[model samples]
Target: MSSASLKRLAVAVVAAAGAFALAMPTASATPARDNVKDKAEVIGKGKEKEKTVPVRLLSINDLHGNLEPPTGSSGRIADETGTVVDGVGGAAYLATYVKQYKNKDTVLVAAGDLIGASPLLSAAYHDEPTVEFLDMLGLSTSSAGNHEFDEGYTELKRIMKGGCHPVDGCSPAGKWKGSKFDFIAANVLDKKNKHALAPFYLEKINGEKVAFIGLVTATTPSIVTASGIAGLKFTEEVAAANRTSKFLAKRGVKAQVVLVHEGDQVTPNQSPDACPVVPGLGSRIANGLDAEVDLVISGHSHQAYICKVNDPKGNPRVFTQGSSFGRVLTQIDFQIDKNTGDIVRSSVVADNHVVRRTVTPDAQTVAFIDLWKSRTSAVANKPIGRITADMPNTASASGEVPLGNLIADAQLEGTKTGGNAQIALMNPGGIRAGLTYAGSSAGEGDGVVTYGEAFTVQPFNNLMQVVTLTGAQLKLLLEQQWVGGPNNQAFTKILQPSSNFTYTYSTSAAWGTKVSNIKIDGQPVTDAQTIRVAANNFLVGGGDAFAAFTSGTDLWSGPLDIDAFAAYLGAHSPVAPPVANHITVIP
Candidate 1:
């Protein structure tokens, strides 16, 4: 079948192997804390004595729907000594770990990013397989990550409340049933209702009430495409969590866990169990949390660490993040006093464990993943292009990456005819993975790039947009790359320019004057010049703190970013890595 026909069929049947209906379904402590199992404890004296309920909380974050074992750097994690541990994650292996650690009082949960930016096996069906996988694994609740809003709030509601896709009806598997597990967002509120989509989810652990307050990062609005999240408001994470904690406390729910999809990045090669003090959003929120909030499980930064941060009342609290793609799981054990229904802060112990593939994989989970693979394989396996060598995401001294340059070039080519785009700038964050020349386990020949592989590299499906910006505004866009600038970026995020665009920047130059010698097609640009720029809608709308892009005029929307990339690959078969020489760095 031709590519177009295959695409139609894929959309029609979703992967076509099964005939079924759609159903929707669904922390840490030590850097190396010893095994602390959940056990009831005795408190009080004689007649007044009661058994304190012990609760075991198991968590994973930033899963990003890796039904199969992740490969490369995404699959490995650092040990206590900073040694890399490989072959760490797969859904089946993760399930085996969960089973071993779970007890009668165990509640499995996540800190958001359960879906979005997924592999082809999951993203093909709009991540329905991931939703089913979570439900099958017995997830109880989760927070909503910023990526959860990738397609917008309406689709998120559909994912939560079961329904057929408005555009593409039921998959070959039949009607979709929303998630059985709850997704709470304390900070994301509806503009009209002035209430959160779901403030919090309450779980009962052996008669003890545990409140899970889910919150997305407050900077969600600045990161996600503004259009998808139209009519929604993202408030401050710390304030929202505190407000929710106080409300739940008034209602007699004392044991609280804040699962916010925001976190800090630890040093590379940092041990997962080590608690090094880092100034991160996760640290700030954990420290600002009310004393009533006993634990904070976080995601978004995709770093794994078991850090101890003190709450507002100076009580030691555990703040953790399990590495992304199901590579790590955090086990938290705490006891609730039966008399006061409050958590014993001293009893809290948290540890991070690798989801090692050494264990026997869960039979049920293997079968489940295989089922989805069979369905998605038809479209996923089709070859789109070829590559001479791997185009990894490794950045140069100037912070430009070959993969990002290729993507920007693709975006530029994709928009030239339709939108008359003269230049394209791709955000580093938008490029998820690299293209490899070697064939994957799927049996596609080496040097062959399949549609699935391409999709994995650019999975967000952001629209390709062309907008006109004056040379001055364009200069401001480049100036926003570093700290102490108009945009106040946390770190330098040099935009990957197309092969035709070039510029120079000096780290020692004063803010706003760092960028110079801006050129498009070998011509120096003037302040009064107007240039057509091509980028994903997210960046064009000011994502990644590039607010200068919002000043562009004459907006022109084209195909989905993924489509543009795939088309570029097909047209430029036997593609090779682009040089990261477009940007010049100065001392």
Candidate 2:
């Protein structure tokens, strides 16, 4: 800890907090500007002054198989979009970020979603690249996100141990590597015996005992497909955290924190143009948590915020979460009584830095990503299609995207040839990718969206399904998007229907309202009408945490989403991705 720098920082903190006080509360806050000293708890009886040790933690969540820096999406996401904040998610910039703040005491952590349903860039390389990147960045450990189980426990075990997949031929001369950090899951259970997989992880840092309890939302089984996690069960988060904290205490560790992939429930603030950063589900979890845990870091909801609130147990806990895609990082600093090893008080300081792709990559880290990049370049660079303009895929987990609409359309078009297909539906989770537009690289670039871009847009191998749904049943599916959670508002809006059909939605109405004006092929759908539709099997089997999809009638599995997309791009060759011209909610 540098005393001189701390003094300078202290002075700046006071001056900035004064300025911020003029505005009172704000959506985004800075430590220097917010003057957080007043909010901290004083330790040592305020008699003796000890130098505050600034523990800098750099964190990211939901990496979801991103290996390259900013320009990975046919160099699209690395380039441009209103929703797209540029940052190379690859390990190089991350390594640089870690090194700048890292002393022997620094901690690097992730909330969840670091793998699964990944792109060929990482998946083609068998998620080798992502693991290698994290190892290079020196991640402390991570809580298990749902995607970790996409291939079931077998693959996850292989990833942890062998660091590679059992691909017939990933390399005759190469190796698959595992991550540097341990993966802990406090709550994921095996149903056969109802036992925890990896309970919790604790470490001694700077002579202070810090405990980490990892968990995912209990409803994860419903969010992911039943098949992918058929024999496993996810337990309630708060209960799991409490139990794990007790376990750590028995092991002689006191300071406790929770790393969860679940996020908050927030609507856009009054300023729609500026993304509304508000307390999300993370906030709720913090409020309901046990007193033992001192901090909570959240993801999955994709909103950025920091707050100090009392849990249901009435113990104060500091909570923070940066938005997704490595755009920002939340750093928490605290003081623990040396004798008792209890956190006296803490201040929340955060820095949201973009992963600027054009910046020089850290040599060693860049080499790691490049080695895999060169090996997978053949499929990575293959031209998929051309988009004259951008089809931005920047919506948060709780929102919709224009690219989602386009892909849904493509699924509809490709599946409609048979008598089984009429309307196309998509799960927000399955559409894990986006198409690249022409001018997405740093400055002026190409107008052609390639096949690689389309593949990136539809990364999951979730096959497409044409199912039969009665008009009433379709309405039921829409309603499931928000029900069966701890609350009515626990989820986001359902994927919007294609232009050929339109549905009415009202937040004022309770969940599961009908698609009143439902139209298909210029005809209104009535109760007696049974319509054929295209949806992913995950949705058909009630994925998205939406249970209604479990009832799709007369199911038929067609080509997987990526293959269908390839066909759509081929037919629309040299065509701009159909812009999101239709579909609107009538207020």
Best by TM-score: 1
Kindly provide the TM-score of model 1 when superposed on the true structure, using C-alpha atoms: 0.91
Q: Write the per-residue lDDT of candidate 1 for residues 1-587, one digit (tens) a residue.
A: 23333233223322221321221011011001111112232243562455577889999999998989987667789976789988998899999999899987898989998999998899888888999989888888899999888878888878877798898788778899887876777777665434345556666666667778888998888889897789988878887777767766765778889999999888888888877746778888889988999899999988999888888878898889898999998999999898888889889898889888989999999998999889989999999888899888778899999989989999999999979999999999887777878899899989999998888888998999999999999999999888787665867788999999999999889988999999999999999999999999999999999999999999999998989888998999889999889999887
My TM-score estimates for the predictions, one after another, are 0.91, 0.80
- The whole-model lDDT of each prediction reads 0.82, 0.62
Angstrom error of the Cα, residue 246, model 2: value is 1.5
Off by over 4 Å in 1: 1-51
Best by lDDT: 1
Model 1 root-mean-square deviation: 10.5
